[model samples]
Structures are given as C-alpha cells and as structure tokens.
Target: MNLKVSKEAAEWYKNEMDLKQGDYIQYYVQLYGGIPTVHPNYSLGVSIGKAENIAIKDVVEGITFYFNSDDAWFLEEFDMEVVFEKEELEFIFHKK
Candidate 1:
C-alpha cells in the first residue's frame, strides 16, 4: 500500500496517520474483525471493495498515509511518500 500525505493536511497533521499490514488483518478475519480501529497513534480502517488493490479501499476521510512506521507492523514492507496536494488523499495499494 502506498500512502501519500497532502501538504495541506500535513500542516496540521504533522504526523497523524500510519498504515501497516500485520498478521492482525489476516488474523482479525478469523475472529471477524475486519480492520482494527485501535491504533496507538491513530485509529485505522480499510476501504471495503472487491477491488484488486487495498489502496482502492475507501480512503478514510481526514486520513492520509505520509510515512511508514518502523514500529508499524505490516504484512510486508512498502514505500512511503508525502504528497503536497490539498485535495482528498487516496491510498493506492500496489499488489506485491
């Protein structure tokens, strides 16, 4: 998943959002928990769709992926980018 932050949001966010893939997303499905809403820094969720890319999932309002967490557990490692656009931020999940 590629998360980009817009300069506009970054001004206030500073460091608001974190995207990670952990065994949790997979495990949660078993327990019937889709996306965990409990994140240490920010509450997180995923866009729901049969879309091939997870990024295509609903980009939650007021959330953007600006940086990755070394401490953030993910299914695998990915790239992080900060966008300067003031428009809505959308995450594009490239299938690995």
Candidate 2:
C-alpha cells in the first residue's frame, strides 16, 4: 500500500492539530462514524500518536503521517491520499 499527503492537507493538519516538526500523525481503521469508501461500514480515523510498526507512511512539512501494521488489512488493496478540499481533509483511495 502507498500513502500520500497533499501540501495543503499537511498544512491544515499542522495548524488544526497544533503539531510541530517530528510529530506523528496516525491513520487507522475506525469501526464506525465516518464516511466509508474502501470498506463497507468502516472508515478511517486520524490521531496524533507514535507508531509501533509502520505499514505505510508519508512525510510532509516535517510531520510524519503513518498507518501502523495492525491497520494494514484496511489499506492493503489501495493507495490512499489525503487532500485539503472544501475546507476539510478528504481521503481518496485508489484500488491497487
């Protein structure tokens, strides 16, 4: 799997999350409550935390954004991109 983050999206995260250089942004599969794309009844979640085992990652504006190994199954068949649009962060998935 692959991960990408747009510069605009990265900037948005840095400001909204009050992040600094070297901070980590984690992406994981959330069981509920978000718009589903790749999975039925499931969605992605984001948080500021350290990664135990990085599966896929992207660095932008000095921040590290990644998905831990445990979430690999959720992303294994797709390449994910994060972008800033409509004043919000949007996830785009490309099936691999």
Against the true structure, whose lDDT is highest? 2
**Relative to the unseen true structure, what is the C-alpha lDDT of residue 73 in candidate 1, on a scale of 0 to 100?**
42
- Candidate 2, residues 1-96, lDDT tens digits: the string is 899999999999999999999999998888777646679888888899794698789999999999898887887888989999999888899998
lDDT of 1 by residue, 11-50 (tens): 4333333423221110111122433322323323433122
Work out how many backbone clashes candidate 1 has: 4
Can you list the residue pairs that collide in candidate 2? none
Count backbone overlaps in model 2. Answer: 0
RMSD of 2: 1.2
Cα error, candidate 1, residue 88 (Å):
0.5
Least well predicted 10-residue stretch by lDDT in candidate 1: 21-30
Name the TM-score of candidate 1: 0.25
Regions of candidate 2 where Cα sits further than 4 Å from its true position: none
Candidate lDDT scores, in order, read 0.32, 0.88
In candidate 1, how many Å is residue 49 off?
A: 29
